[model samples]
Target: MRLRGRKGIRESLEKQEDLVVLQPSLWKGRWSEYFGNSNPIHVELGMGKGKFISELSILHPDINYIGIDMYDELLRKASGKVRFRREEDGIGLDNIALALMNIQGIEDVFAPGELERIYLNFSDPWPKNKHARRRLTHPGFVNKYLSLLNARGEIHFKTDSRNLFEFSLNSFADLKLRMRAISLDLHSDGLREDLVPTEYELKFVSQGMPIYRCEVVVGQQSLEAHEIRLKQEGRV
Candidate 1:
């Protein structure tokens, strides 16, 4: 998913001071010092080209944002966008940062109970029975998120694929996560005016695809059960 003719973007990212390089193996427990704030932290996994998070950072200056993607080239493009916005508009978007890392290593990048919110925007469906474990909604990744999320944290998700949406719904239910809100078609009838469009979300809407969205709330009971299971499995 690397973009061609991105030399200018690469140079822009290199010049950006806000884009943080998060090497999971090295910065396992040092994110708090990097941000220098006890304020709530929000993360977007598989941030793609970073349209959603970049806009979000501009909209929410109080909350710190961390965008994660595995592709170095994609992140470079995303970082370039953020840098351009800051340079042109003097947006002072210092609260946002980009990390080149995989979601599976999320625990290694942030301390336990550090993230206040998580966003999953149009992640790869990995639509095969044999690849179920690779899906972001799978229990393995859910457990990882549970460990990192605060007590009242929530995970927001949006996708245009019905199969992936259905699979994620079932995975949340199986994990005992309560769905606080859901919209089968985000752009129809009455939609929130404050809703911002992601890069893929906008494309999907233009193509006549319905975007499904939901928020899952983490409960104390579910957290306790997760902790017990983790202990029993020697995960702690």
Candidate 2:
């Protein structure tokens, strides 16, 4: 949930220097360098309030994590969550960074092949046919993601919206991306290990909503083919 136009919201975000970087261009291609490590980088593409990625960084300290969200309303809350964890634990996870950017402009901030993994969690469905191209799983965004990811890189996606899940599956297939894992009902499907519930994920699971998940691998060479298929489908 958005904090809804909190006064000085931008200033609040500015105070969170230990957790998020509001201006990320300086560390664009040198992201891993900011972390002082060569570990593989993974990004959560639409990290609303970021509960998932923060926990993920704690769990997989060996891997670097970046959380990108467009709203300061969301980032402000996420920063507080991380700061509270640090205050209580005496050791906040250091393997994480946050960026505020429109997903479409991500290409301007990161070099091609910079990410080893990307996660799209409960993205906006953009359910109407006219708005389909704006969906995060649309071929346009998928192609951009593929370009940013290193060869053999994988994207992990999760959603509670069945329509979006099905749509994303078709998007991945259209790109001929290989799927290594899929779960139509993740919480009850016997794939419980390593499942770190995001804030929204917890709410949905509490209400008995089924969560959909999949892992897709795309190669750099296959990108052109995906674009060709998009034009063929008139999705362009």
Candidate 3:
């Protein structure tokens, strides 16, 4: 469902420099200053169309939010949403920033222990076994996240794909990581007041599909053990 080849999309994104960060790596380790406050920074990794992050920014002005996506069209659309919401709500855009970049280079954009939380909303399933390495929740990516997150930081994930959800659970377990707030049917009892459903989540829920959700907390011991395992497996 990604928008493709929309003319002038790149230009549109360039014009959104106030909202879109073109050189995120330069801001590494300085996100707090970029946001002009010491507010905890939260990221919507692989944020698609920007609906969820935009809503979250509006809901929690106390937090600094970054939304990252690889597609220029998606980033453009997300910028529009944030801009419209700002005007609609009369809120300044200081708390929100968008980046158009691939997630694999995320470490270059934020220094170690820079992030407080990361949201993975409806990420690509990458179902094939050969492609498992590319899944965001894969152990390799989890290792990268560990390097970027503070000691107590957490990764919040939600998805409608059962295969991906099961894989993620096992992946975290393999690292001996701690997980909490697991839900096999997130909206079954009615949406939580604080929850802001992503665009894909809303579509799937309307069709009676279940959403799987979990939060993985960063633990020093688990991280050390996971790194050892990776080294033994010649993965690190």
**Which predicted model would earn the best TM-score?**
3
The alpha-carbon lDDT assigned to residue 121 of candidate 1 equals 91
**Candidate 1 lDDT by residue in tens digits, 1-236:** 54465556556555665575745446556666677777778899999888889888888888889999987678887887887877776877568889878777788788888888899999889889899999898889988998888875789999988899999999999998877558899987543468878888878787878999998877465457656876998978
Off by over 4 Å in 3: 219-236
Ranking by lDDT: 3, 2, 1
- CA lDDT, every prediction? 0.80, 0.83, 0.89
Model 3, 55-88: lDDT tens per residue? Answer: 9999999999999998887888889899998999
lDDT of 2 by residue, 1-236 (tens): 33468789898778777678888877889987788888989999888877888878777889988999988888877777766666676766578888888888888878899888899999888889899988999999998988889864778899999999999999999988877569899998543667877888888888888999997867654455556766998988
lDDT of 1: 0.80
Candidate 2: the clashing residue pairs are none
95 Cα displacement, candidate 1 (Å)? 0.4
Candidate with better TM-score, 1 vs 2: 2
Give the range of the ten consecutive residues with the poorest summed lDDT in model 1.
Answer: 1-10
Q: Candidates' TM-scores?
A: 0.85, 0.87, 0.90
Summing lDDT over every window of 10 consecutive residues in candidate 2, give the lowest-scoring window: 218-227
Q: Of 2 and 3, which scores higher on TM-score?
A: 3
Ranking by TM-score: 3, 2, 1
Selected candidate, larger lDDT, 1 vs 2: 2
